[model samples]
Target: MKAQGVVLATRYVLVTLIALLVILPFALMFMATFREHTDIIRRGPLALPQHFSVDNFRKVLFQHHFDRYYLNSILITVPVVGGSLVFALMSAFALSVMDFPLKRFFLLGVVSFGVMIPEVFIMIPLFQLMHGLGLVNNLLSVILPSLAMSACFSTLVIRSFFMGLPRELLDSAMVDGATFWEILWKIYTPLAIPAIVTSGALTAVWTWNTYITPLVLIHDPLKMPLPLGLALFQGQYVANVPLIMTGATLTALPPIVVYLLLQPRVVLGITQGALK
Candidate 1:
Protein backbone atom coordinates (compact mmCIF):
# COMPACT_ATOMS: atom_id res chain seq x y z
CA MET A 1 0.00 0.00 0.00
CA LYS A 2 2.79 2.43 0.86
CA ALA A 3 4.59 1.65 -2.41
CA GLN A 4 1.41 2.17 -4.44
CA GLY A 5 0.72 5.46 -2.60
CA VAL A 6 4.23 6.70 -3.40
CA VAL A 7 3.79 5.84 -7.08
CA LEU A 8 0.50 7.73 -7.28
CA ALA A 9 2.01 10.75 -5.55
CA THR A 10 4.96 10.77 -7.94
CA ARG A 11 2.63 10.60 -10.95
CA TYR A 12 0.58 13.51 -9.66
CA VAL A 13 3.70 15.62 -9.07
CA LEU A 14 5.03 14.85 -12.55
CA VAL A 15 1.76 15.82 -14.20
CA THR A 16 1.60 19.07 -12.21
CA LEU A 17 5.15 19.91 -13.22
CA ILE A 18 4.42 19.28 -16.90
CA ALA A 19 1.27 21.38 -16.70
CA LEU A 20 3.22 24.26 -15.17
CA LEU A 21 5.88 24.03 -17.89
CA VAL A 22 3.19 24.30 -20.58
CA ILE A 23 1.37 27.16 -18.86
CA LEU A 24 4.36 29.24 -17.71
CA PRO A 25 5.11 30.81 -21.09
CA PHE A 26 1.58 32.14 -21.54
CA ALA A 27 1.53 33.36 -17.94
CA LEU A 28 4.84 35.17 -18.35
CA MET A 29 3.72 36.67 -21.63
CA PHE A 30 0.55 37.96 -19.99
CA MET A 31 2.64 39.55 -17.25
CA ALA A 32 5.07 40.94 -19.79
CA THR A 33 2.24 42.70 -21.57
CA PHE A 34 1.57 44.77 -18.46
CA ARG A 35 5.24 45.15 -17.50
CA GLU A 36 7.03 48.40 -18.21
CA HIS A 37 9.54 48.39 -21.07
CA THR A 38 12.30 49.40 -18.67
CA ASP A 39 11.27 46.68 -16.22
CA ILE A 40 11.40 44.11 -18.98
CA ILE A 41 14.96 45.25 -19.85
CA ARG A 42 16.30 45.43 -16.27
CA ARG A 43 14.52 42.52 -14.63
CA GLY A 44 14.43 38.90 -15.76
CA PRO A 45 11.28 37.89 -17.66
CA LEU A 46 9.78 36.00 -14.67
CA ALA A 47 9.99 39.05 -12.39
CA LEU A 48 6.80 40.78 -11.37
CA PRO A 49 5.93 44.04 -13.06
CA GLN A 50 6.31 47.32 -11.12
CA HIS A 51 2.91 48.47 -12.28
CA PHE A 52 0.31 46.62 -14.33
CA SER A 53 -0.99 48.66 -17.21
CA VAL A 54 -3.06 48.16 -20.35
CA ASP A 55 -0.66 50.47 -22.21
CA ASN A 56 0.82 47.62 -24.26
CA PHE A 57 -2.57 46.62 -25.65
CA ARG A 58 -3.39 50.30 -26.26
CA LYS A 59 -0.23 50.76 -28.30
CA VAL A 60 -0.91 47.58 -30.26
CA LEU A 61 -4.51 48.51 -31.08
CA PHE A 62 -4.16 52.24 -31.75
CA GLN A 63 -0.52 52.81 -32.69
CA HIS A 64 0.25 49.67 -34.67
CA HIS A 65 -3.10 49.50 -36.53
CA PHE A 66 -3.66 45.89 -35.48
CA ASP A 67 -7.41 46.34 -35.89
CA ARG A 68 -7.12 46.10 -39.65
CA TYR A 69 -4.80 43.14 -39.36
CA TYR A 70 -7.23 41.46 -36.97
CA LEU A 71 -9.99 41.94 -39.50
CA ASN A 72 -7.76 40.60 -42.26
CA SER A 73 -6.95 37.50 -40.20
CA ILE A 74 -10.65 36.90 -39.62
CA LEU A 75 -11.43 37.27 -43.30
CA ILE A 76 -8.74 34.78 -44.29
CA THR A 77 -9.47 32.23 -41.55
CA VAL A 78 -13.27 32.21 -42.01
CA PRO A 79 -13.20 31.54 -45.75
CA VAL A 80 -10.50 28.90 -45.44
CA VAL A 81 -12.32 27.04 -42.68
CA GLY A 82 -15.71 27.19 -44.41
CA GLY A 83 -14.38 26.35 -47.86
CA SER A 84 -12.23 23.52 -46.55
CA LEU A 85 -15.21 21.97 -44.77
CA VAL A 86 -17.34 22.17 -47.90
CA PHE A 87 -14.71 20.64 -50.16
CA ALA A 88 -13.75 18.01 -47.62
CA LEU A 89 -17.37 16.92 -47.20
CA MET A 90 -17.90 16.59 -50.93
CA SER A 91 -14.60 14.81 -51.49
CA ALA A 92 -15.19 12.41 -48.61
CA PHE A 93 -18.74 11.63 -49.80
CA ALA A 94 -17.56 10.98 -53.37
CA LEU A 95 -14.63 8.87 -52.23
CA SER A 96 -16.77 6.80 -49.89
CA VAL A 97 -19.93 6.31 -52.02
CA MET A 98 -19.11 6.88 -55.67
CA ASP A 99 -17.81 3.98 -57.76
CA PHE A 100 -15.88 4.37 -60.97
CA PRO A 101 -12.90 2.88 -62.81
CA LEU A 102 -9.46 4.01 -61.65
CA LYS A 103 -11.05 5.32 -58.43
CA ARG A 104 -8.65 3.42 -56.21
CA PHE A 105 -5.71 4.50 -58.37
CA PHE A 106 -6.86 8.12 -58.24
CA LEU A 107 -7.35 7.92 -54.48
CA LEU A 108 -3.96 6.36 -53.93
CA GLY A 109 -2.05 8.43 -56.50
CA VAL A 110 -3.66 11.78 -55.85
CA VAL A 111 -5.57 12.12 -52.56
CA SER A 112 -3.44 9.73 -50.50
CA PHE A 113 -0.22 11.23 -51.77
CA GLY A 114 -1.58 14.75 -51.29
CA VAL A 115 -2.15 14.02 -47.60
CA MET A 116 1.59 13.57 -47.09
CA ILE A 117 2.88 16.34 -49.37
CA PRO A 118 4.08 19.29 -47.30
CA GLU A 119 2.91 22.71 -48.44
CA VAL A 120 6.47 24.09 -48.24
CA PHE A 121 7.68 21.65 -50.90
CA ILE A 122 5.42 23.28 -53.51
CA MET A 123 5.71 26.90 -52.35
CA ILE A 124 7.74 27.98 -55.32
CA PRO A 125 5.42 26.43 -57.87
CA LEU A 126 2.39 27.65 -55.96
CA PHE A 127 3.83 31.17 -55.96
CA GLN A 128 4.54 30.99 -59.69
CA LEU A 129 1.02 29.79 -60.37
CA MET A 130 -0.47 32.55 -58.24
CA HIS A 131 1.76 35.11 -59.96
CA GLY A 132 0.70 33.87 -63.37
CA LEU A 133 -2.92 34.37 -62.37
CA GLY A 134 -2.19 37.87 -60.96
CA LEU A 135 -3.18 36.80 -57.44
CA VAL A 136 0.07 37.76 -55.72
CA ASN A 137 -0.52 40.12 -52.76
CA ASN A 138 -4.24 39.55 -53.15
CA LEU A 139 -6.33 37.77 -50.46
CA LEU A 140 -7.56 35.40 -53.16
CA SER A 141 -4.08 33.97 -53.45
CA VAL A 142 -4.23 32.86 -49.83
CA ILE A 143 -7.90 31.84 -49.87
CA LEU A 144 -7.70 29.85 -53.11
CA PRO A 145 -4.59 27.97 -52.05
CA SER A 146 -6.09 27.39 -48.62
CA LEU A 147 -9.13 25.83 -50.27
CA ALA A 148 -6.92 23.74 -52.50
CA MET A 149 -4.67 22.55 -49.69
CA SER A 150 -7.15 22.33 -46.77
CA ALA A 151 -7.02 19.44 -44.27
CA CYS A 152 -6.36 16.01 -45.78
CA PHE A 153 -7.09 14.73 -42.29
CA SER A 154 -10.58 16.17 -42.66
CA THR A 155 -11.11 14.17 -45.85
CA LEU A 156 -9.97 11.00 -44.10
CA VAL A 157 -12.08 11.74 -41.05
CA ILE A 158 -15.27 12.55 -42.95
CA ARG A 159 -14.71 9.59 -45.22
CA SER A 160 -14.47 7.30 -42.21
CA PHE A 161 -17.68 8.77 -40.79
CA PHE A 162 -19.45 8.51 -44.15
CA MET A 163 -18.40 4.88 -44.65
CA GLY A 164 -19.63 3.92 -41.22
CA LEU A 165 -23.13 5.23 -41.95
CA PRO A 166 -25.63 2.49 -42.89
CA ARG A 167 -26.25 2.20 -46.64
CA GLU A 168 -29.94 1.74 -45.82
CA LEU A 169 -30.11 5.35 -44.56
CA LEU A 170 -28.98 6.67 -47.94
CA ASP A 171 -31.20 4.16 -49.73
CA SER A 172 -34.18 5.22 -47.63
CA ALA A 173 -33.51 8.85 -48.49
CA MET A 174 -33.40 7.83 -52.14
CA VAL A 175 -36.68 5.91 -51.81
CA ASP A 176 -38.30 9.07 -50.57
CA GLY A 177 -37.37 10.71 -53.87
CA ALA A 178 -34.39 12.50 -52.29
CA THR A 179 -31.76 13.44 -54.83
CA PHE A 180 -28.06 13.24 -54.01
CA TRP A 181 -28.15 16.90 -53.17
CA GLU A 182 -31.08 16.42 -50.82
CA ILE A 183 -29.53 13.39 -49.14
CA LEU A 184 -26.26 15.25 -48.75
CA TRP A 185 -27.81 18.43 -47.44
CA LYS A 186 -30.45 16.83 -45.24
CA ILE A 187 -28.80 13.69 -43.96
CA TYR A 188 -25.02 13.97 -44.24
CA THR A 189 -24.83 17.60 -43.22
CA PRO A 190 -26.95 17.09 -40.14
CA LEU A 191 -25.05 14.00 -38.97
CA ALA A 192 -21.60 15.33 -39.86
CA ILE A 193 -21.64 18.12 -37.27
CA PRO A 194 -18.78 16.63 -35.31
CA ALA A 195 -16.60 16.17 -38.38
CA ILE A 196 -17.37 19.71 -39.44
CA VAL A 197 -16.45 21.18 -36.08
CA THR A 198 -13.34 19.05 -35.76
CA SER A 199 -12.22 19.89 -39.30
CA GLY A 200 -13.35 23.52 -39.32
CA ALA A 201 -11.74 24.35 -35.98
CA LEU A 202 -8.51 22.65 -37.00
CA THR A 203 -8.45 24.53 -40.32
CA ALA A 204 -9.38 27.84 -38.69
CA VAL A 205 -6.59 27.63 -36.14
CA TRP A 206 -4.10 26.73 -38.90
CA THR A 207 -5.28 29.55 -41.17
CA TRP A 208 -5.18 32.03 -38.29
CA ASN A 209 -1.57 31.10 -37.56
CA THR A 210 -0.54 30.85 -41.22
CA TYR A 211 2.74 32.76 -41.49
CA ILE A 212 5.01 31.18 -44.09
CA THR A 213 2.76 31.44 -47.15
CA PRO A 214 1.50 34.86 -46.10
CA LEU A 215 5.07 36.00 -45.50
CA VAL A 216 6.22 34.80 -48.90
CA LEU A 217 3.21 35.95 -50.90
CA ILE A 218 2.27 39.19 -49.18
CA HIS A 219 4.50 42.26 -49.30
CA ASP A 220 1.64 44.65 -48.63
CA PRO A 221 1.60 45.20 -44.84
CA LEU A 222 -2.00 46.40 -44.88
CA LYS A 223 -3.15 43.18 -46.55
CA MET A 224 -1.39 40.95 -44.02
CA PRO A 225 -2.91 38.89 -41.20
CA LEU A 226 -2.38 38.96 -37.42
CA PRO A 227 0.76 36.83 -37.63
CA LEU A 228 2.33 39.38 -39.98
CA GLY A 229 1.17 42.21 -37.75
CA LEU A 230 2.92 40.58 -34.79
CA ALA A 231 6.16 40.79 -36.80
CA LEU A 232 5.92 44.57 -36.94
CA PHE A 233 6.27 44.74 -33.14
CA GLN A 234 9.98 43.99 -33.48
CA GLY A 235 12.47 46.55 -34.82
CA GLN A 236 16.16 46.41 -35.79
CA TYR A 237 17.79 47.80 -32.64
CA VAL A 238 15.06 47.68 -30.00
CA ALA A 239 12.31 45.06 -29.76
CA ASN A 240 9.16 46.04 -27.92
CA VAL A 241 8.70 42.90 -25.87
CA PRO A 242 5.66 44.20 -24.03
CA LEU A 243 3.92 45.30 -27.20
CA ILE A 244 4.86 42.03 -28.88
CA MET A 245 3.35 40.02 -26.06
CA THR A 246 0.24 42.15 -26.17
CA GLY A 247 -0.09 41.65 -29.91
CA ALA A 248 0.47 37.91 -29.53
CA THR A 249 -2.11 37.68 -26.80
CA LEU A 250 -4.62 39.50 -28.97
CA THR A 251 -3.82 37.31 -31.93
CA ALA A 252 -4.27 34.14 -29.85
CA LEU A 253 -7.73 35.18 -28.66
CA PRO A 254 -9.75 34.58 -31.82
CA PRO A 255 -9.02 30.88 -32.26
CA ILE A 256 -9.25 30.25 -28.53
CA VAL A 257 -12.60 32.01 -28.48
CA VAL A 258 -13.75 29.98 -31.47
CA TYR A 259 -12.65 26.70 -29.91
CA LEU A 260 -14.31 27.54 -26.64
CA LEU A 261 -17.56 28.43 -28.35
CA LEU A 262 -17.77 25.18 -30.31
CA GLN A 263 -15.83 22.94 -27.92
CA PRO A 264 -18.86 21.06 -26.59
CA ARG A 265 -20.18 20.21 -30.05
CA VAL A 266 -16.73 19.45 -31.37
CA VAL A 267 -16.03 16.99 -28.60
CA LEU A 268 -19.45 15.37 -28.84
CA GLY A 269 -19.36 15.11 -32.63
CA ILE A 270 -15.87 13.61 -32.87
CA THR A 271 -16.91 10.96 -30.35
CA GLN A 272 -20.21 10.08 -32.00
CA GLY A 273 -19.10 10.59 -35.60
CA ALA A 274 -16.15 8.26 -35.15
CA LEU A 275 -18.62 5.41 -34.70
CA LYS A 276 -20.93 6.23 -37.67
Candidate 2:
Protein backbone atom coordinates (compact mmCIF):
# COMPACT_ATOMS: atom_id res chain seq x y z
CA MET A 1 0.00 0.00 0.00
CA LYS A 2 2.81 2.39 0.85
CA ALA A 3 4.59 1.63 -2.45
CA GLN A 4 1.36 2.18 -4.43
CA GLY A 5 0.73 5.42 -2.59
CA VAL A 6 4.29 6.61 -3.41
CA VAL A 7 3.72 5.77 -7.10
CA LEU A 8 0.44 7.71 -7.13
CA ALA A 9 2.08 10.72 -5.46
CA THR A 10 4.92 10.64 -7.98
CA ARG A 11 2.49 10.47 -10.89
CA TYR A 12 0.51 13.43 -9.56
CA VAL A 13 3.65 15.52 -9.16
CA LEU A 14 4.85 14.66 -12.67
CA VAL A 15 1.50 15.57 -14.21
CA THR A 16 1.33 18.85 -12.34
CA LEU A 17 4.83 19.77 -13.46
CA ILE A 18 4.02 18.94 -17.08
CA ALA A 19 0.80 20.94 -16.92
CA LEU A 20 2.63 23.99 -15.58
CA LEU A 21 5.31 23.71 -18.27
CA VAL A 22 2.68 23.58 -20.99
CA ILE A 23 0.59 26.45 -19.58
CA LEU A 24 3.39 28.82 -18.58
CA PRO A 25 3.92 30.29 -22.05
CA PHE A 26 0.20 31.05 -22.46
CA ALA A 27 0.12 32.57 -18.96
CA LEU A 28 3.10 34.77 -19.86
CA MET A 29 1.44 35.84 -23.11
CA PHE A 30 -1.72 36.82 -21.23
CA MET A 31 0.28 38.81 -18.73
CA ALA A 32 2.31 40.51 -21.46
CA THR A 33 -0.88 41.97 -22.95
CA PHE A 34 -1.37 44.05 -19.81
CA ARG A 35 2.22 45.37 -19.79
CA GLU A 36 3.63 48.41 -21.54
CA HIS A 37 5.70 47.66 -24.66
CA THR A 38 8.76 49.47 -23.21
CA ASP A 39 8.48 47.55 -19.95
CA ILE A 40 8.28 44.24 -21.89
CA ILE A 41 11.33 45.21 -23.99
CA ARG A 42 13.35 46.36 -20.98
CA ARG A 43 12.47 43.66 -18.42
CA GLY A 44 11.83 40.85 -20.90
CA PRO A 45 8.64 38.81 -21.49
CA LEU A 46 8.78 36.95 -18.16
CA ALA A 47 9.01 40.01 -15.95
CA LEU A 48 5.97 41.52 -14.25
CA PRO A 49 4.84 44.84 -15.65
CA GLN A 50 5.44 47.98 -13.60
CA HIS A 51 1.85 49.00 -14.27
CA PHE A 52 -1.02 46.97 -15.72
CA SER A 53 -2.87 48.92 -18.36
CA VAL A 54 -5.78 48.38 -20.73
CA ASP A 55 -4.23 50.89 -23.10
CA ASN A 56 -2.83 48.20 -25.38
CA PHE A 57 -6.22 46.55 -25.62
CA ARG A 58 -7.78 49.94 -26.39
CA LYS A 59 -5.27 50.56 -29.14
CA VAL A 60 -5.81 47.09 -30.62
CA LEU A 61 -9.58 47.46 -30.64
CA PHE A 62 -9.91 51.10 -31.69
CA GLN A 63 -6.79 52.01 -33.64
CA HIS A 64 -6.28 48.59 -35.25
CA HIS A 65 -9.97 47.84 -35.96
CA PHE A 66 -9.81 44.55 -34.12
CA ASP A 67 -13.57 44.79 -33.63
CA ARG A 68 -14.16 44.79 -37.40
CA TYR A 69 -11.81 41.87 -37.78
CA TYR A 70 -13.69 40.15 -34.96
CA LEU A 71 -16.95 40.68 -36.84
CA ASN A 72 -15.44 39.20 -39.98
CA SER A 73 -14.32 36.15 -37.98
CA ILE A 74 -17.87 35.69 -36.68
CA LEU A 75 -19.31 36.02 -40.14
CA ILE A 76 -16.97 33.34 -41.47
CA THR A 77 -17.01 30.97 -38.47
CA VAL A 78 -20.79 30.93 -38.00
CA PRO A 79 -21.60 29.87 -41.52
CA VAL A 80 -18.78 27.34 -41.65
CA VAL A 81 -19.85 25.71 -38.41
CA GLY A 82 -23.55 25.72 -39.21
CA GLY A 83 -23.18 24.56 -42.79
CA SER A 84 -20.68 21.87 -41.87
CA LEU A 85 -22.85 20.46 -39.11
CA VAL A 86 -25.92 20.39 -41.31
CA PHE A 87 -24.13 18.67 -44.17
CA ALA A 88 -22.18 16.30 -41.91
CA LEU A 89 -25.26 15.15 -40.03
CA MET A 90 -27.01 14.23 -43.26
CA SER A 91 -23.97 12.49 -44.73
CA ALA A 92 -23.31 10.63 -41.50
CA PHE A 93 -26.90 9.48 -41.27
CA ALA A 94 -26.83 8.16 -44.83
CA LEU A 95 -23.54 6.42 -44.26
CA SER A 96 -24.43 5.03 -40.85
CA VAL A 97 -28.08 3.91 -41.04
CA MET A 98 -29.03 3.50 -44.66
CA ASP A 99 -28.03 0.79 -47.08
CA PHE A 100 -26.33 1.86 -50.27
CA PRO A 101 -23.73 0.75 -52.80
CA LEU A 102 -20.13 1.73 -52.06
CA LYS A 103 -21.15 2.94 -48.59
CA ARG A 104 -18.13 1.41 -46.86
CA PHE A 105 -15.83 2.72 -49.57
CA PHE A 106 -17.26 6.21 -49.16
CA LEU A 107 -16.89 6.10 -45.38
CA LEU A 108 -13.31 4.89 -45.73
CA GLY A 109 -12.61 7.68 -48.18
CA VAL A 110 -13.94 10.29 -45.79
CA VAL A 111 -12.14 8.85 -42.76
CA SER A 112 -8.84 8.33 -44.55
CA PHE A 113 -8.45 10.37 -47.70
CA GLY A 114 -10.17 13.56 -46.59
CA VAL A 115 -8.00 13.87 -43.49
CA MET A 116 -4.77 12.67 -45.12
CA ILE A 117 -4.74 15.51 -47.62
CA PRO A 118 -3.47 18.64 -45.97
CA GLU A 119 -5.18 21.87 -47.06
CA VAL A 120 -1.80 23.52 -47.66
CA PHE A 121 -0.98 20.99 -50.34
CA ILE A 122 -3.90 22.15 -52.47
CA MET A 123 -3.81 25.88 -51.64
CA ILE A 124 -2.31 26.84 -54.98
CA PRO A 125 -4.98 24.99 -56.96
CA LEU A 126 -7.66 26.25 -54.58
CA PHE A 127 -6.44 29.82 -55.09
CA GLN A 128 -6.67 29.38 -58.82
CA LEU A 129 -10.19 27.94 -58.54
CA MET A 130 -11.32 30.76 -56.25
CA HIS A 131 -9.85 33.34 -58.61
CA GLY A 132 -11.54 31.68 -61.55
CA LEU A 133 -14.83 31.88 -59.70
CA GLY A 134 -14.11 35.57 -59.00
CA LEU A 135 -14.12 34.80 -55.26
CA VAL A 136 -10.67 36.19 -54.55
CA ASN A 137 -10.74 38.36 -51.42
CA ASN A 138 -14.32 37.15 -50.80
CA LEU A 139 -15.30 35.68 -47.43
CA LEU A 140 -17.13 32.86 -49.24
CA SER A 141 -13.79 31.63 -50.54
CA VAL A 142 -12.78 30.92 -46.96
CA ILE A 143 -16.22 29.76 -45.84
CA LEU A 144 -16.78 27.20 -48.62
CA PRO A 145 -13.45 25.40 -48.25
CA SER A 146 -13.69 25.43 -44.45
CA LEU A 147 -17.23 24.08 -44.63
CA ALA A 148 -16.16 21.19 -46.88
CA MET A 149 -13.22 20.21 -44.68
CA SER A 150 -15.22 20.53 -41.45
CA ALA A 151 -18.07 18.49 -42.86
CA CYS A 152 -15.76 15.70 -43.99
CA PHE A 153 -14.22 15.20 -40.53
CA SER A 154 -17.44 15.88 -38.68
CA THR A 155 -19.19 13.18 -40.75
CA LEU A 156 -16.80 10.59 -39.36
CA VAL A 157 -17.53 11.67 -35.80
CA ILE A 158 -21.31 11.86 -36.20
CA ARG A 159 -21.35 8.56 -38.14
CA SER A 160 -19.55 6.81 -35.29
CA PHE A 161 -22.12 8.12 -32.83
CA PHE A 162 -25.02 7.13 -35.08
CA MET A 163 -23.62 3.63 -35.59
CA GLY A 164 -23.60 3.13 -31.83
CA LEU A 165 -27.32 3.82 -31.56
CA PRO A 166 -29.66 0.88 -30.98
CA ARG A 167 -30.74 -0.74 -34.22
CA GLU A 168 -34.19 -1.54 -32.82
CA LEU A 169 -35.08 2.13 -32.45
CA LEU A 170 -34.48 2.83 -36.14
CA ASP A 171 -36.38 -0.31 -37.13
CA SER A 172 -39.37 0.72 -35.01
CA ALA A 173 -39.33 4.17 -36.58
CA MET A 174 -39.34 2.58 -40.01
CA VAL A 175 -42.37 0.42 -39.07
CA ASP A 176 -44.33 3.60 -38.30
CA GLY A 177 -43.97 4.70 -41.96
CA ALA A 178 -41.32 7.28 -41.06
CA THR A 179 -39.34 8.36 -44.10
CA PHE A 180 -35.57 8.62 -43.94
CA TRP A 181 -35.81 12.34 -43.36
CA GLU A 182 -38.38 11.86 -40.60
CA ILE A 183 -36.29 9.18 -38.90
CA LEU A 184 -33.22 11.37 -39.18
CA TRP A 185 -34.91 14.42 -37.70
CA LYS A 186 -37.15 12.71 -35.15
CA ILE A 187 -34.88 9.94 -33.91
CA TYR A 188 -31.20 10.15 -34.78
CA THR A 189 -30.69 13.89 -34.31
CA PRO A 190 -31.88 14.12 -30.71
CA LEU A 191 -29.79 11.14 -29.61
CA ALA A 192 -26.74 12.45 -31.45
CA ILE A 193 -26.88 15.96 -29.95
CA PRO A 194 -23.65 15.43 -28.01
CA ALA A 195 -21.77 14.37 -31.13
CA ILE A 196 -23.26 17.22 -33.14
CA VAL A 197 -22.26 19.72 -30.49
CA THR A 198 -18.78 18.22 -30.37
CA SER A 199 -18.37 18.50 -34.12
CA GLY A 200 -19.81 22.03 -34.20
CA ALA A 201 -17.50 23.24 -31.42
CA LEU A 202 -14.45 21.66 -33.03
CA THR A 203 -15.35 23.06 -36.46
CA ALA A 204 -15.93 26.52 -35.02
CA VAL A 205 -12.50 26.53 -33.38
CA TRP A 206 -10.79 25.30 -36.57
CA THR A 207 -12.56 27.84 -38.75
CA TRP A 208 -11.91 30.70 -36.34
CA ASN A 209 -8.16 30.00 -36.18
CA THR A 210 -7.69 29.32 -39.90
CA TYR A 211 -4.91 31.68 -41.03
CA ILE A 212 -3.30 30.19 -44.10
CA THR A 213 -6.43 29.83 -46.24
CA PRO A 214 -7.59 33.36 -45.53
CA LEU A 215 -4.10 34.80 -45.94
CA VAL A 216 -3.70 33.09 -49.32
CA LEU A 217 -7.15 33.79 -50.75
CA ILE A 218 -8.09 37.10 -49.18
CA HIS A 219 -6.18 40.20 -50.28
CA ASP A 220 -8.52 42.85 -48.92
CA PRO A 221 -7.49 44.06 -45.48
CA LEU A 222 -11.08 44.94 -44.67
CA LYS A 223 -12.21 41.36 -45.36
CA MET A 224 -9.42 39.84 -43.22
CA PRO A 225 -10.43 37.77 -40.17
CA LEU A 226 -8.95 37.97 -36.67
CA PRO A 227 -6.04 35.59 -37.22
CA LEU A 228 -4.89 37.61 -40.25
CA GLY A 229 -5.80 40.86 -38.55
CA LEU A 230 -3.43 40.00 -35.69
CA ALA A 231 -0.57 40.11 -38.18
CA LEU A 232 -1.24 43.75 -38.99
CA PHE A 233 0.17 44.71 -35.57
CA GLN A 234 3.60 43.41 -36.57
CA GLY A 235 5.70 45.78 -38.66
CA GLN A 236 8.77 45.07 -40.81
CA TYR A 237 11.19 46.74 -38.36
CA VAL A 238 9.29 47.18 -35.06
CA ALA A 239 6.62 44.94 -33.57
CA ASN A 240 4.23 46.04 -30.84
CA VAL A 241 4.44 43.11 -28.46
CA PRO A 242 1.79 44.34 -26.05
CA LEU A 243 -0.69 45.23 -28.77
CA ILE A 244 -0.02 41.97 -30.60
CA MET A 245 -0.59 40.03 -27.38
CA THR A 246 -3.77 42.02 -26.78
CA GLY A 247 -5.01 41.08 -30.25
CA ALA A 248 -4.02 37.46 -29.61
CA THR A 249 -6.00 37.47 -26.39
CA LEU A 250 -9.05 38.87 -28.17
CA THR A 251 -8.66 36.48 -31.09
CA ALA A 252 -8.48 33.50 -28.73
CA LEU A 253 -11.48 34.31 -26.54
CA PRO A 254 -14.41 33.23 -28.75
CA PRO A 255 -13.18 29.67 -29.49
CA ILE A 256 -12.26 29.34 -25.81
CA VAL A 257 -15.77 30.41 -24.85
CA VAL A 258 -17.35 28.02 -27.39
CA TYR A 259 -15.25 25.07 -26.17
CA LEU A 260 -16.13 25.85 -22.55
CA LEU A 261 -19.81 25.99 -23.37
CA LEU A 262 -19.78 22.69 -25.25
CA GLN A 263 -17.14 20.86 -23.18
CA PRO A 264 -19.60 18.58 -21.39
CA ARG A 265 -21.23 17.42 -24.62
CA VAL A 266 -17.86 16.96 -26.28
CA VAL A 267 -16.58 14.82 -23.40
CA LEU A 268 -19.72 12.69 -23.31
CA GLY A 269 -19.76 12.19 -27.08
CA ILE A 270 -16.11 11.20 -27.22
CA THR A 271 -16.45 8.83 -24.29
CA GLN A 272 -19.57 7.11 -25.62
CA GLY A 273 -18.24 6.94 -29.15
CA ALA A 274 -15.04 5.30 -27.96
CA LEU A 275 -16.90 2.71 -25.86
CA LYS A 276 -19.08 1.67 -28.79
What tens-digit string does per-residue lDDT give for candidate 1 at 12-63? Answer: 9999999999989888888888987778778877798788678878888887
List of clashing residue pairs for candidate 1: none
In terms of lDDT, model 2 sits at: 0.85
Candidate 2, TM-score vs. the true structure?
Answer: 0.90
- Clash count, candidate 1: 0
Output candidate 1 Cα RMSD.
3.1
Best by TM-score: 2
lDDT of 1 at 58: 87
